[model samples]
Target: MAYSLDGVLVFGLLFVCTCAYFRKVPRLKAWLLSGSGVWGVFYKAAVIGTRLHAAVAISCIVMAFYVLFIK
Candidate 1:
């Protein structure tokens, strides 16, 4: 339940990418944003820290929602 740094960074990245999208950034950039979020989660998961894994898992779920429904 505490937030990890990767989670915070991923959230900030998503927010920035969303703003960029609103500013008319290309679809490629948005996809890269989402891709990097997934990469970050996978990296955290592979490293094997329980709290970090939990944070990454939560980020993945939230990002999935945004990717599926928001965009």
Candidate 2:
């Protein structure tokens, strides 16, 4: 398997963004969770041959609902 420096950097940035955003803005917590859900499904599809775009999209949709209706 080939090691990807770009992939490592992307994920590293995502992790740092998650940590920093969670600490500064509480509202972004839900949005970050939604984005991470999308990332997880995407990464799983890339690494494990899983097709879960619908699930990831739904997660984002539900989060949108919470942002618009609940929050």
Candidate 3:
């Protein structure tokens, strides 16, 4: 199939949501939380999730499906 910017955008969004969803998984969490100094701490804080992350992931996945199937 031919690839377009829409495909790339959708893939990029899904990738982000996947990272967000997986940020809490044990090994990934350690890796995701791993960084250095202030950046490390800030990185963990940024990736650590509340339900908002799930919502964002769900919405993005839905959008991804729409883009892939409909658009």
Candidate 4:
């Protein structure tokens, strides 16, 4: 796979998975990270994503590995 934006995206998702696993993101409090507006949208997504970390993480790894091995 090309080490471009796709790589960055995958790495970011994996990072999010790690953060979500440790409950470091999607904070319930109304602070800077979880504030309203654009961050709010992200926070909401993170809330759901963190709850489904297992499925998300597994699928991401599977897809990445599949792409890597296919070439």
RMSD of each: 12.3, 16.1, 4.7, 4.2
Model 1, which residues run further than 4 Å from truth?
A: 1-45, 48-51
Q: What lDDT is reached at residue 28 by model 2?
A: 51
Estimate, for each residue in 1-71, the C-alpha lDDT of model 4 and write its tens digit.
34776677676676556545534634434353453777765565566567887888787887688668953
Top candidate when judged by TM-score against the true structure:
4
Q: Which 10-residue window of candidate 3 scores lowest in summed lDDT?
A: 42-51
- For all candidates, the clash counts are 0, 0, 0, 0
Model 3: residues with Cα > 4 Å off, grouped in runs: 36-62
Alpha carbon lDDT of residue 60, candidate 3?
72
Ranking by TM-score: 4, 3, 1, 2
Q: Would you list the clashing residue pairs of candidate 4?
A: none
lDDT of 2 by residue, 1-67 (tens): 1256544544544444344445345665444434455555433333222244355446546655754
Q: Would you give me the overall lDDT of model 1?
A: 0.50
For 1-71, candidate 3 gives per-residue lDDT tens digits of 12887667565555555665556577876666466775474344345433367766686778768867887
lDDT of each: 0.50, 0.46, 0.60, 0.62
Clashes of 1: 0
Task: Supply the global lDDT for candidate 2.
Answer: 0.46
Flag clash pairs in model 2.
none
Best by lDDT: 4
Give the TM-scores of the predictions, in the order they appear.
Answer: 0.33, 0.31, 0.49, 0.52
